[model samples]
Each structure stands twice: as C-alpha cells, then as structure tokens.
Target chain A: MIFRALIPAFMFAILIVFFWTGLSLDPSKVPSPLIGKPVPAFELPRLSVPEQTLSSEQLQGQVSLFNVWATWCVGCRQEHDMLLAIADENLVPIYGLNYKDEREAALRWLRELGDPYAATAVDADGRVSIDWGVYGAPETFLIDRDGIVRYKHIGPLSAEDWENELRPRIQSLLDNST
Target chain B: MRVLLAALMLLPLAVVAIDQDPPMADPQLQARYEKLSNELRCLVCQNQSIADSTAPLADDLRQQVREMLIAGRSDNEILDYMVERYGDFVRYRPAFNDRTWLLWVGPFAVIAIALVIGVRVVRRGMGEVESD
Candidate 1:
C-alpha cells in the first residue's frame, strides 16, 4: 500500500525533471552537421577586388577562421572589435565571407571599421553561404590545416568565447596537425 | 482619374505576392517545387515553412528548390541536398532515422504505459473495496 502511494510522486518527479531540462536548452543553437567534415567547396568573388575570385583552396594550407558577416547585421558589428583584436594576434588567418551585401557598402564597412580578414569573399546571391550551412550572419567556422571545419560558433563571438571555447579547439588542431 | 485613383490607392488592395520570377513552365515541376518548399522549414523563422516565410534565406531556399525541380533533380535528391547542408532540422517532418525512432515511438510508449498503470490502479481500487 505504501509502495503504490509512491508511484504518483515518482511520476511527478520525472515530469518535473523533464520540463526542467527543456527550460535550459537553447533552440537556436542547432548543432552543425559539418563538424568533422571538409569545408564545402565554393568559389566567390573577392569583396575588395570583385574581378578576382576567392576559392576554398586558400584555406587548405593553414588553420584559419571563416567568419560570415554582412554590413546590415548588428551582431557582426558587435563582434568586429573582437575579430580585430584576434587578427592582431595573428594566431590564425581570418577569412571573411561577406554575405549578400552590396559591394560598395561592404567595402566602405571594411574601410571605416578595420579589415580583420586576410581575404574577404563576396557571396552576392548567397549560394555559397548555403553550401557552408550559414543560417545567419556572424557565424564563425574554425578550419584546420587540411581545410576540415573543426568548430562552428553561432552568434557574435565574444572574448570569453574565444578564450574558453575556440582557443582550446584551435590549440588541439594545431597540436594534432603537426 | 477617380477610378484610377480608387484602383491604385483608395482600394484596400494588399498584394502579398512579391516573387518577381515567373511560375515554372512545367506544371508537374511546379507542383514538386511547391510541395518541397512547404515541407522544408525556414531556419530563420523556426515556425514557418520556406513557402510561408518572407525571409531572404527562405527565398533563396525556395529558388534552390524550384531550380532543382527544373533541373530534373528528384525530390529525394533535393531533400538530400538540403539535409546535407542544414542537417535534419530543415525538415518539418523529420525522417524516421536512428536518432528520431525514439521520437516517433515515444508517444505510443507513453500511451501503453498509461494503459498498464490505469489497469493496475483500477484493479487495486477494486481489491481495496472488496477488503472493506
């Protein structure tokens, strides 16, 4: 009789635990499928010099960062200072994927703000961005020496994010690649 | 002039159609495009399918679906293309894969558990009444 009485309490406890787990999950931070996969092949025009093209080949030889940014996205602006600071360290080359903005406005943004990227690729129609699985602006991908995407950071990256999450991943990649 | 004014401005005319591209020439292909767009979820606007979303990413995805249909790509191939890039989250109706088998089975399992519990509870109640 006493054992049967505890059943309701057990079920209630399970329900409470289930709902509590749901509360902590961030729905927007969907895990990327390309985590262990090679970076998707793409060839897009360079943002600075449109006549020239930037291809995935450039990322092949070194561990680097691929940052997707646009002139219109506020998050990209928020992360720009961190990107500039990271660029100064020269820890890894940062290649920018300038998503869907006009050439002139993007060029002006780089000029006025500061160019943190070693090369900026212009994805005008967003076809290349689709291949990269970029859902929003300010998403960053960490690529290793062989051009495999090691890590993906969604939203604007913070200093804490770099130090805590990304730097460790990059360190492991560097340690393993050698 | 008044009629022109009424037609252009005074009438409560709300044009929701913003697609500049003409409809696909092939009706069969057009149907496929429509079905696929409605099935694919817009990652930006989590609730709406790509067909219903006004987001630019949704527009680009819709264009991709239409173009793939016109290019003679199978529906499965088109879906695979999306799943490869965006993962299974792009599908509103997730596939019955190893990861999602639990999701598909979970509701039925809960019902089965409820039935067992209900039967046991009722039997126990009857036993208590008999003892009284």
Candidate 2:
C-alpha cells in the first residue's frame, strides 16, 4: 500500500528527469538524413571560371570535403584558417559550394584569405544547396571514395574539431577505401 | 492621367513582390502547395513555417515544393522527399515513429496517471469518512 501511494511521485520524478536531460541538448545539432547516403547531384558553374561547370560525378573515387559557405557567413570566416590548414596538408581535396553569394565578393574574399578549395562551385540561386539539404552556410560534409556522404559537421570548424572529430573520420575513410 | 497609368503599370510588379505567383493553373493543386509549404518548418528559422519565413533557404524550399507540385507529385511523396533530405525536424508535426513515440504518448500518459491518482485519493478520503 505504501509503495502503491508512491507511484505517482515516482512517475513525476521520471518526467522531471527526462525534461532536465532534454534541456542540455542543443536542438541545432539535429542529425542530417544525408549521412551514409549518396551526395546529391548538382551541376554548378565554377566560381573562378563561370564557363566551366563542376558536377557531383567529378567527386567520385576519392575522399573529399564539400564545404558549403558564403562570403557573408561569419561562421565561414571563423573556419577559414582551419580549412586552409587542412587543405595545405593535402590529405583530402576540399571543394567549396559558394551559396547564394555574389561572384565579385566571393572572388575578392578568396583573394584576400587565399583559396583553400581545389574547385569552388557557384550556387548563385542556392538551388543546388537545397538539394544538399543545406539550411545554413558553413556546413561541411565528408564524402567517401564511392561518393557517399560519410559525415557532416554543422557550424564553424575549429582546430579542436579537426583534431578530435574530422581527422579521425577522414583517416578511417581513407583506410577503408584502400 | 499619368499617375493612373503609372499605378496600372506597377500592378504586375506589386504581385511579383508579394510572391503571389501561383505555382499551377489548377486551383486544387495550388491549394495543396500552399498547405504543404505552410506545414513545413523552415530549418534555418526553426520557429517559422517555410511559407512564413523569408530566409533564403526557405525561399529555395518553397521553389522546390512549387516545382515538385507542378510535376504532379502527391502530397505524401513531396513530404517524404523533404524528410529524406532534411530529416523529421523539417516537418512541423513529426510522424509517430520509434524515435518520436515518447513525444506522442507522453502527454496522454501523464494525464492518465494524474486521473488515477486523483481517483485513488478520493476513494481513500471516502473510506476515512465512513469510518468516522
């Protein structure tokens, strides 16, 4: 009888515990469905040379990083140095999706910051970005040799993130491919 | 006369600015498009539906929905496409699945528990009164 009377309190306590646990989680870190799926197909003009177009087919048979960014995105600026360092290592080819940004401004920003991307595609209308399910700029996807998106990182990429999260994943993918 | 002519000339521009260009010629299809767009949450805004959000990503989604609707895709097909791309978070009301079972059943469970407790307390009070 005593235990039966305590049931409501126990249930209420459980509810409170669930709510408390939920409060600590960041809603923005919602996992992408594209993880483990093939990267979306896109044919976009090259940022440097509009006459030349880049397609998803070109990304096959190599581990690559597809970074969605814009000159106007402050987070992209924050991640620029880390991206440059990664590019310098030549461990993996980094491609850029210039989302809904002006050609002149994108070119100028690249010139000032130094181009870290092997090939930057201009998604001027942001149509291609939609296919990639890009909600905001500065989202990075790690694509495997078979053109499958192995992992995605949202928000700015920091040195700690690269060292802890990105490098390990890249190494594993490279190891798996060979 | 000139002012009247200018107003008439600007009418089409006003329609374009308001984004009132209907996606399809059929009224039923346009209605479905509007309903689906309003039901979708803009991932960037997080708070507003795609129809209400002015975010660039929202605009892209709206355009995609329009094109898909024009292609005669069913409502469920379009929604599944969005879910495939953006996950369940993009839907304003998520489907009841393994991951979301707690969310759907939690409220009713709480209410049922409360009712049971209330009934048991009232019964105990009645027993005490009878003994007195």
Candidate 3:
C-alpha cells in the first residue's frame, strides 16, 4: 500500500531531476553535424585584395582554423584579442571567413585592430557560410591536415576555452598528423 | 497634382518596407518550397519556422531549398540535406528515434499511469462506502 502511494512521488521526483538537468545545459551550444566531414567547398575573394580568390583547395596539407566572423558581430570583437594571440604563437594557420559585411568596414576593423588571419575570405552573400552550416557569426571550425573538420566552436571563444579545449585538440591533431 | 506627388513619394518607401523576395517562377516548385520552409525550424530564431523568420540564416536556408528544388531534388532529399547539415533540431516535428523515443512515448505513458492510479483510488473509495 505504501509502495503504491510512493509511485507518483517517485515519478514526480524523476521528472523534476530530468527538467533540472535539461535546464542547466547551455542552449546556445548546438552540436555541428559537419564534424568528421570534409570542409565544404568554397571559392571566395580575399578580404584584403578582392581580385585574388581563396579556395578550399588551399586549406589542404595543414591543420588550420576557419573562423566565420563579421565586422557587425560584437562577439567577433570580443574574441579578436584571443585570435591575435593564437596567431602570434603560430600554432596553426587561422583563416577568416568575413561573413556578409561591407568591404570598407571589415577592412577598417582589421586595420584598426590587427590582422590575425593568414588569409581572410570575403563571403559577400554568406553562401559559403551556409555550406558550412554557420547559423550565426563568430563560429570556428578546426580542420585537420586532410581538410576534414575535427571540431566546431560556437560563440565567442575565451582564453580559458583556448587553453583547455582548442589548444589541446590542435596539439593532438598535430601530433597524430606527423 | 500635390496628391500625385505625395503618392509618388510614398512609392519608394513602400517598396523598401516590403522585405520578402518575389515568388519563384514555377508555381508547383514554389508551393513545395513554401511547405518545406514552413516545416523547417529557424536555428537563429528557435521558435519560428524558416518561412516566418527574418533572420539572415533563415533566408539562406530558404534560398538553399529553392536551389535544391531547381536542381530536381525531391522533398525528402531536401529535408535529408537540411537534417544532415543541422541535425534533427532543424526539424519542427522531430523523427521518432533513439534520442527522441522518450519524447514520443512519454505522454502516452503518463496518461496510462494516471488512468491506473485513478482506477485504484476509485475502487478503494467504493470499498469504503460499501463498508459504511
């Protein structure tokens, strides 16, 4: 009799636990389906010099970071210093996908701040970004030596995020490739 | 003459305010495009479907669906393409699978349990009345 009465309470407790666990998780961090798949093919003009095109073929032969950012995105500015620092260390080549921003504004932003990217591509219509399944600005993908995307980080990356998650992943990929 | 001039002045403003792109050439294809767009969730907006969302990402996805349709892809192929890229989260009505089994079955299970409990409680109350 007691066990029968406790059943509803037990079920209610379990439901509460599930709801609590679900609520605690960050909703912004949606897992990318492109992980372990080859980087989507794209041919975009260089942000610095529009006449010269930068294609996905160039991304082959080395582990690299492809960062989708825009001059208008506030989060891109937040993560800019970390990107600059990453570039300084020369750990991996950082390629920028300048997503749907005016040429003058993007150029000025990079000029005023610093150019962290080895080569920045202009995704004028955001077609390439769509191919990469980029829902918003300031998303980063880590591609391996063979051009397979290994990791995807959404939102502005912090210094702690770099040290703990990104750096170690890059190091492990580098170690395995050689 | 003054009213005509005012109407002309308002024309450009009206054009600028109307945001949606013109409908596609093929009516059948356009119908399919609209249906699929309504079904797919806007990742940026979360709540609104791609057809209703004004987000740039939603616009891109809509354009992608149109292109795929033009390329002679079927509705299932287009849906598969989106699901492959964005995961099951892009679908407003998620498929029944391992991850979604509880979501599909939980409501029915709850109802069944409630019915069982109600029967037991009613039977106990009936017994008490008979004893009285």
Candidate 4:
C-alpha cells in the first residue's frame, strides 16, 4: 500500500519537475522596450516588385503592421493565412520584410500561398532584420498612426491571440485615434 | 647499400621529431587554437560559444586555452586537460560515455518506461463494469 501510494506521488513529482524544467528552459523570453518605440528607419529593395523599395516613412500616417518573415521559415507559413484574413478586412496596412530569402523563392512562396503584404521588402543579407533586433523570423510589430510600434507579437498568431490580445489592443488604439 | 642510405636519412628525421616540438613552433597551432576556442561552448552560458560570451568564466577559459597553446601543449593534450578539469560540459560535443548516457538517451528511455508502465497499469485497472 505504501509502495503504491509512493509510486503515484513519485510520478506526480517527476511530472511537476519536468513541467517546471520545461518552463525554465525558455531563457530567451526577455522582453524588449523597442515595441512601443518608432519603427527603425530603413529602406529595403522590393522582393517581387521591380525598381521599388519599402521604407519606414510609409508607416508614419496610418496604423500598420510590420511582419518579419522569410521563405525558408515555417512559422511564417502558419501566420500567412491569418495575415491574409487581416488584410482582407482592411484593418491596417500589413508591410512585410522578407529576411534572408531569395527573391525568386519569396515570389514563388507568395504565388502558392497568397501575398497579404501591402509592400514586401527583401532583406537579402538579414542586416535589416538584425537592426530591428530580430532573433528569428515570423515576428509581428503593430505600429500606431504616429509611427510608434505599439505591440510586438513573437511567433505565430492564433485565434486566442486575436480575441484576447489583438482585438482589445487594436480597439484601444483605434478608440484613441478618434 | 640502398637500405643503409635510407636508414641514414630516416635517423636524422627521427632525431628531429624527438627534439622539435610541433605545438608552439608552428604558426598554424595558434590559428587552430583560436578556431577551436570559438567552436567550444561556454559551460556556464550553456548556449553561447566561448568567443561570443562576455562571462568572466568564459574569459578565464579562453585565456587558459590561449595560455595552453603558448605553453607548447599539443591540441589533444590541452583538450584532455580541460576534459579532466571541467568534464564534458566544457566541450561543445560531449563524447558518449556511461555518465552521459542520461544526456544521450534519457528522453527515449523515459518515454519507453512511461509507455510500458502506463500500459500495464491501465490494463490491470480496466474492467467491463459499464452502466447504461
């Protein structure tokens, strides 16, 4: 009886420990204040559009979303459809910075999936990505009308994020706009 | 006569090999040391390369590696010394051994054990005592 009782307790303890260790394993969860600041000034060549470039100046007048993605990335694909849905709603101008991707592959990816970006710029060498303090691809930054980045959502967005995080925040920003 | 001449030439080479140490005298040794230092993981940092880490311990380890190279230690000898002092954590790739079986096979073993125990426990507890 004691062995059986202790076995369950031991199992529970081990499970709890595993969960705690997993939680503590994420050491790169440090937050950045660059979220509420103005988008860093940069000009990058357009990925598909010829003789065209995208700049942070274009984000000044309206509330916009800057999405950092790449053709080689997987999470970007998961977020692509949601981005397209948002774009379809015409909620905000969704700008894209394709980090360290071949122009041809980026074009092909967009052709297969769908391009949700108002303007997509190619960051061929990832220099722009580094300047933006990007650790990896598929990070979304929401910029307010005054060109201040109000929110930065790392990784892929989900329905919970839409309802709990995005809607409330965007509604507030919109309310403040009027 | 030919064998004797070959032996005569080989005698000087053997003598030179014994007298001349290859570690400090070679320019390539310093370059190799620098390259290997960066490739090594900082034990404290866990995620950072020794070259990239700004930790005091990492700095000390880097300085020790440099000192070992300067002191005419062979690459293998230096690695052996570090392995002896710090164990496998000092290396980016720890070798497979009895102590590191947990590092290599712990996850798989845990999963297998869990599956076996779960199946046995569930099988013993299950019954057709269904009520409509």
Give the candidates in order of DockQ, highest first. 1, 2, 3, 4
The regions of model 3 sitting more than 4 angstroms off are A1-9, B1-19, B123-132
Tens digit per residue, CA lDDT, model 4, B31-131: 86667677666654668876677654456566667777878788777766656544466667667888677888988998999999999877666743332
Model 2 regions more than 4 Å off: A1-16, B1-25
Residue-wise lDDT of candidate 4 within A135-178, one digit each (tens)?
54688888899998888787787768766877678778878979
How good is model 1 by TM-score? Answer: 0.91
| lDDT tens readout by residue for model 2, B15-129 | 6332445557888988998899899989888888988888777877888888898898999999998988889888988888998888889899989988998999999999999
Where's the lowest-lDDT run of ten residues in candidate 1 chain B?
B10-19
lDDT-sorted candidate list, best first? 1, 3, 2, 4
Docking class of 1: medium
> What digit string (tens of lDDT, one per residue) describes model 3 on residues A126-176?
888877888877999999999999999999989998998899999999999
Model 4: iRMSD? 14.3
DockQ, each predicted model: 0.72, 0.63, 0.56, 0.03
Q: After superposition, how far is residue A47 of candidate 2 from its true place, in Å?
A: 1.6
Judge candidate 4 against the unseen true structure and give its global Cα lDDT, from 0 to 1. 0.75
Ranking by TM-score: 1, 2, 3, 4
Worst 10 residues of 3 chain A by lDDT: A24-33
TM-scores vs. true structure, each candidate? 0.91, 0.86, 0.85, 0.53
Residues B1-132 of candidate 3: C-alpha lDDT, one tens digit per residue: 999999999998775421277888999999998899999989898888998888888888888899999999999999988887887788887788888789889999999998998999999999999999
Which has the better TM-score: candidate 1, or candidate 3?
1
Evaluated on CA atoms against the true complex, candidate 1 attains a DockQ of: 0.72
Chain B alone, model 2: TM-score? 0.81
